[model samples]
Target: YINDVCRTLREEMKRAGIHAEVHAWQKHLASISRKLEYVPRQSNENPLSQLHDLVSFRILVDTDNECYLALGHIHALWRPKDGRIKDFIATPKLNGYQSLHTTVFCLHDCLAEIQIRTHDMQRTATYGIASFWYLKDRMGKEGSPNSWKLSYKEMVTWIEQLRQWQQELPESADEFVEAFKGDVFQDQIFVFTPKGEVKDLPRGSTPLDMAYRIHTDLGDHCAGARIITNMDESGCLVTRQVPLDYELKGGEIVALLTNPAVHPTRDWLHFARTNAARNKIRRYLKTYERESQQADASAPVPGCQTTTMTIHAQDRPGLFRDLTAIFADGGINIGSVSSTVQERSRAIISLSFHLPPSLKETLRALLHQIQALHEIEHVALEPHDDTF
Candidate 1:
């Protein structure tokens, strides 16, 4: 079985343009006895530690995007068995290992497991146990102790959860083991932020999972979800509504809106299949629950304040960052900001920040900086009232 499997794998590797070599070891008891006066033939047999018929294939790629492209090529070439595609790059393994895996039938009804990962991912997987040792060897320096603290914390949490599960359901150890294997190692979904940051989530993630992916605060405060893509007459995406919960495919973008009044429910925990999403919801609920218990904790009564400034510049990178940095440096908090991009390659940024006592001078200096950028056609300030 091993020889046949190895031969099929080698063929596949060549077809996929990967370079690899396989080696097998064997020993004969008769040969060993004849070679020496005292010959010992030892065979280590441990059923629990027995090696499985898993074949790991490493593929090198130029970039993260190329990694997904390789996955597509491999899947298209092989018929993956149902529920056999696992993408850890999107969700990653518990120890922060990332890869793409699939099981397929190769040569005469024989099933083979294939693991795909980039060169860097392979190094991380092999040396992650002695991560600090590798890092010191590479950089000739030691990193801060705090670098490993998060890993330690995650380990402790896993241990505590395991103990709790054992205590709560002592008779279901086998069931727990099976479920743990299924849950702890699984494929990931790739979702996007409104600004296009990729978020790798566990399979079966919802828009709520997306919200938490942005930030815990955003997730807890998520009131509702809005799928940003257009729908057809049947309401299914000509491109599909990025599936919520099931394994998320690569190249899906999502956005989330939040309201402070929203709170998570126990049902959310049930529906939230990912540990990250569930833990975030629980944390948010606990925090808000405590806040509610301590004080009035009512949503801040809606109120409004307003100011207006005219921005004159060609839209450029870091323009918003630069403008906001000025206000932030001056300790002027923004109430709102809006901008209009014109066809003539000009833009007007209108900002509504807390009115400072020295408003005129601040406005003048900001306008001067904007004008100094050499892109401003003109600048103006308008009087505005505190009404939303």
Candidate 2:
């Protein structure tokens, strides 16, 4: 069942273009006796037939959006059981577990549970007894009774990091594990938010990095930060303003400051420590640049919003007067008009006009209006050229 679930999940993810590995596990049933009270494992009749959630699968994608994408694919493949779906991402657990969970009827009427979460959710590491319970649940190994001999926080941090690392690696590694990558979790420092909530970050991480880690919108609008100094006898916080590049020390309470005028520039890439921060800033800048270009394309050219219209029509006596009246009726002001009589009673007339802001978008309709006039053979609005 575990293997089949993994294969099916991977196939669906691949079809949906979601690049994430599915981790699956089955409850290993083994009979053990304290005094033979008759556990379910004691029976050889296969008790799993009566149980749901015997097989479970976990999928970790890059972003919260991808989590839902993968969830949609899973439900489309199998019918989910009613009242069995839980959305912890929208309302996270007390332990801050953010994932979408559902039980589905699958694989020949068997029931399987699926959990979909993003990779970022695991950054909030569990500590103490909670960590021990998690390790036991995932690895099936109970720690020594005196596991507190080492700092519980440090021990569990390493365990969680190691678990995530191991899950991410391929099946084979020719090189020694120590030589593969150095201890990434070792150089981390824990800082505090103004409200005393802890924020774990890498060593030498700046306040700007913390801003981004907290929320992308905060990072985008971040001007600088205020580092907490010692509190007064009244217990009020005393803080000193700091630059974005100021390195945050462990145990310091930092309050991020924002200004609407502030925006991420290329210089942010220089001091931004985390890859997540850098990536978000880059993404925002890219989107901003694209939108600016689109706006510029639609706007009139600065200083000279000159529009030229060329008309080739029959050289009737009232032709010039009728053409002038079109602009007057539409509340347009013609800057200049030039005409030349060509062969066989054909008149080539060119007119230049300055467009107002409100009528900028009506150029197409104006051209259609000119085309509807009598004796109009051909008419065209020339491409905008500032060099003219």
TM-score of 1: 0.36
After superposition, the stretches of candidate 2 with alpha carbons farther than 4 Å from their true spots are 1-186, 230-238, 306-388
- Give the C-alpha lDDT of model 2: 0.68
lDDT of each residue in 1-388, candidate 2, tens digit only: 6788788888889889998978887655542123233336536565545455557888878766687678768866776664456655543444545567777777876788888876445433324346655654554445443323222333345446446444434343422243124324225555667775666666678888889867889999998888874344232446899999998765467989999999999899887876556666777898989988866544555554677889999888888888878777776677778999989989999998767566754655567777888889998777653332
Clashing pairs in 1: 204-245, 204-246, 205-245, 237-240
- Could you report the Cα RMSD, in angstroms, for every candidate shown? 20.4, 23.5
Error of 1 at 274 (Å): 4.2
Model 1 residue 255 lDDT? 53
Instruction: Judging by TM-score against the true structure, name the best candidate.
Output: 2
Instruction: Give stretches of model 1 more than 4 Å off.
Output: 1-57, 62-65, 72-82, 88-98, 103-114, 120-198, 202-206, 221-266, 274-276, 282-388
TM-score of 2: 0.38
